[model samples]
Target chain A: MRKEDMVKLISAEGFEFVIDKDAAMVSQTINNMLTSPGSFAETQHGEVTFPEISTTILEKICKYFYWHLQFASGKETEFPIEPELTLELMMAANYLHT
Target chain B: MMGGICSRKREQLVIENGGCRGVSERFCKIASSKWLGNSFSRPIVDCQPGRGKCPSLMDLCIYKIREDIDKYSSFSILPRDISQQIFNELIHSRCLTDVSLKAFRDCALQDVFLGEYPGVKDSWMDFISSQGSSLLSVDISSSDVTDSGLALLKDCPNLQTFAFNYTDQLSEHGLKHISGLSNLTSLSFKKCDAITAEGMRAFSNLINLEKLDLERCSGIHGGFFHLKGLLKLKSLNIRCCKCVTDLDLKAISGITSLKELQAFSSNITDVGVSYLKGLHNLTMLNLEGCNITNACLESISALVALAVLNLNRCRLNDDGWEKFSGNKNLKVLSLGFSDITDACLVHLKDLTNLESLNLDSCGIGDEGLANLTGLTLLKTLELSDTEVASNGLRHLSGLTNLENLNLSFTLVNDSSLKKLSGLTSLKSLNLDARQITDAGLAALTSLTGLTHLDLFGARISDSGTKCLQYFKNLQSLEICGGGLTDAGVKNIKDLASLTLLNLSQNCNLTDKTLELASGLTALVSLNVSNSCITREGLQYLKPLKNLRSLSLESCKVTASDIKNLQSDALPNLISFRPE
Candidate 1:
């Protein structure tokens, strides 16, 4: 992907996951952070730091973003979620408004 | 300089005080430090002491507000835009209940589109109305707001638009409350039955009202009399209002500024249409299914600005078609199911600006199509159920801009397919005729841009499937001709772009067809009804996660089997046959 089309997401543990802007936009909150008229620091730097979200959950969210894009284009498949991570994932999903 | 030094000391104190509390507290300390710095100088807000950089203070406040929304009672302290964003976020997440709604009471939200939101009732209007003059548009469609609840909006003086569609509880009395809102420009009460002719008296005061949609308002018969004073009213839709008659049209004719009138299926006739001759500015007139005959065309031709005219299913004949010769601006004309024959098409020959013409179910044939050759700008031509045969297809070959051609139920066959091969811009082609055989499908392989191809009634056997390879962009393919077999489906299995695949009535398609089609992962709607596929074929559909509507009617699969698959494999399936 082109550098202009990518975004860096830093988890609470400072683990960085560079992903496509289109995939990261699967989360409505991230889309707002990047495109909202306010021009927040995340939009300026092309990076967002989620201090409350852990590295594992952030990585899973990035995977889900890509899976969501694939599923939208008709490559329908199951998005597996382990039972132990369901609660945290649900909270993150709620925050992201995905 | 002294002020900046004091603020820096204060920020240091705040950071020390907030160091042990974690992220949210640290953000609060930073926000407070920024506020203190704002009093001293603007530069201090942009550059923090220790932190490399901080997010916009507005973003931080919005984040903080979202994290602890219930802790505060009112967002009145924040800027209007910040409060509005918070309100939108709360509403988007569906977390804004009656209790949480109190925080945005006076937040000055400009637009509130809570259409079809559950739990919305009369009580919520108080909080919505609290925005007062700041509220410009509100759509409470499908809500339970009665006249008493609507009365609360009387105080919002600057409110310009309101949509209360399907809010059946609103009666004539409720309209009286909004009569004072002269600034209101657009209002929609679609499918509202309680607003009768008497209730429309309230609209006389709305001088700036430009658009009014009272579609399906069965009670409003003589309502146009009250709308006479709405000088700025440009578009009015009273479609399906069975009670509106010739007298209503007469009352409406006085509004010469009217640009569009949709009175389809109304109780208006030719006499009613004659009353609209004064509306010279009218650009769109839809009298479809109205009792208007050919005599109405004489009056309609006066509408020099008419770009779209729908007279489908009207009492029109060929006698008055010459009246359409003056409508040079006509871009879209729908005369489907009319009594006009090939002779009437001669009048339409001069309408070179016509882009979309619907002659479906008309008596026009080959001679009629010859008159359309000069219409080079024509993009969509519908001749379904007409008498146009293969000979007429030659006339349409010149229409290079034609993107959609529906020749279904016509006499066109294999020989006619070659005429369409040159129309390379065709994206949607419907050949739902029994005469369309494999030879016909093979003749048009040059039209590679085809995205939607319907061969619903065409006879295409296994050998015919070879033509399908050229249509790599086919997103929706229907081959329910009953001639397709497992071998025929094998040719279509690789069409990765296919989202809707219907192979119903093909008795030769057994479980092998499903196995062959398993690779079409993008199939969202698959209909193999009346096929020989058994219950075992359901397993092959597990990979089609986007499959929502699976029709296996007249097959061995039972409703319980579909339910079992829905619970596990096909979790996104919404509609399944035998259920």
Candidate 2:
């Protein structure tokens, strides 16, 4: 993928994940940060760091992003999630505005 | 200063169009140039919504450039809803130019009501065409929209209601394109004089058309023949179509589902009403000034489902209204300015379900109203310009449900008001009695629920208005031709809910009254005609933000005072009558 079409997300354990910018921007908080009039430090380097989110949670979030893309396109299916991660995922969703 | 004026004008436009709903909430978002108090950089960057928090450097540079260019238009940084509100205000104010409209390109608008705008033309439609399938309602009334402009709307599929009233440039060819919009429910072509019988043929394609108003489209004679297939049409108005006789009514009589048909000022007579008996679903029928008589009333009596009927200014007498007794389901009966008398009311008294009975300017006196006393469900009783008096009010005392009562230009004196004072549920009372003075005004103090009280042409003085001060819920108070002065208005000043105050012909009113009137922030229409108010008195009325119509006619106001005052004093003023 072109450099402009992808973004790098760093989790708390320093695990880096490169995802399509379109999927990453699906999160309203990320969309606001990426498209806001004033440029922030994250926009300058095309990378975002989440200190509070762990590597496992971040991986689940990335998977959920792809799932959202499929669901928005009228693909109906269950988005399976581990019962233990449900509370953390919901908290992340609240912060991100989904 | 221009920003201030434009911002206030925008606010006024929104308030005018939205009527105190979303207008004020939307206006609160816009910060004008004066709000900065000398404009130190203007906070244009900070004014940006939260979504504008972290754009790339390239995007930031472009946004900065655009903000600098949009220096005068203070709503540059608002969100889509606020921008849409400003766009609405801009269209109504006739200030929406092509350049300014570019700002709201991303606005997701559902309804675009650009009615009677002088600046709008094909470009506005071109802008609307870009709104895609989301546009649900569009009113381009009295604009320069021609056939070409309407052709642009061919791409707008979801447009359910389209009104082009007085946009007479549109013809049969223009209407043919949109006729295929099966989802369209209402199509108003009122005063589009260019439309002929050929244009009406397009309506057959509008399968879902529920309401169609062709009022004053006199270009066609027998147009109902084309609308015969529009079986879904529930309401149709052909008012002022003189060519529409009983023959046209016979053509549209096939529309059995029609619930309301307003053919006011048409050529349809008694013969035409006879054709409507087959339309069993018709609930409301207005045939005012149609030259119908007792024969028509007899024919209309067969429509048992009719809940409302207006026969105002018809060639009717006592015998005509007698026929109405058969259609016992009538909830509203308007017989204003008719030649009917007490004998008609005797027959009408059987219509116990009647909720509204207007006998204004009818020859119904005390004896006639006695028959109406049995209609205990009667909420509105209009006896203006009749021979009713204090004696007649005794008959109405039993009608506890009476909410609106008009005894204007009647022989009702001080004693009459005493009988009416018992009606605690009376919301609106018009006692334009010539003999009414301060003596009977004390009795009205008990009516705390009164919203509208018209004591016009009465002899009530300052003391009488003092008694009226207790009616805190009064939204409208008309006290013309009285001894009401500044002290009287001081009592009037506390009624904050007052929207319409007609202190006309009260020659004793002066500056003190206007000073007290400044506190009426909710006032919309104020008429101080033929008063003693001087030009200097206007300074006291500067705080009336919602005041739209102010009539100072025959007052002592000078041309200089009016000229000296800025439009900001009464920014929403549309009608200003000064001598």
- Among incorrect, acceptable, medium and high, the docking class of model 1 is incorrect
Predicted structure 2, TM vs. truth: 0.73
Sliding window of 10 residues with minimal summed lDDT for model 1 chain B:
B1-10
CA lDDT of each prediction against the hidden true structure: 0.80, 0.73
> Model 1, A62-91: lDDT tens per residue?
988887777667675555555445446555
What value does the TM-score of chain B take for model 1? 0.86
User: How accurate locally is residue B561 in candidate 2, as Cα lDDT from 0 to 100?
Assistant: 63
Candidate 1 RMSD computed on C-alpha atoms after optimal superposition onto the true structure: 17.7
- Candidate topping DockQ: 1
Show the colliding residue pairs in model 2.
Answer: A36-B52, A36-B53, A36-B54, A36-B55, A37-B52
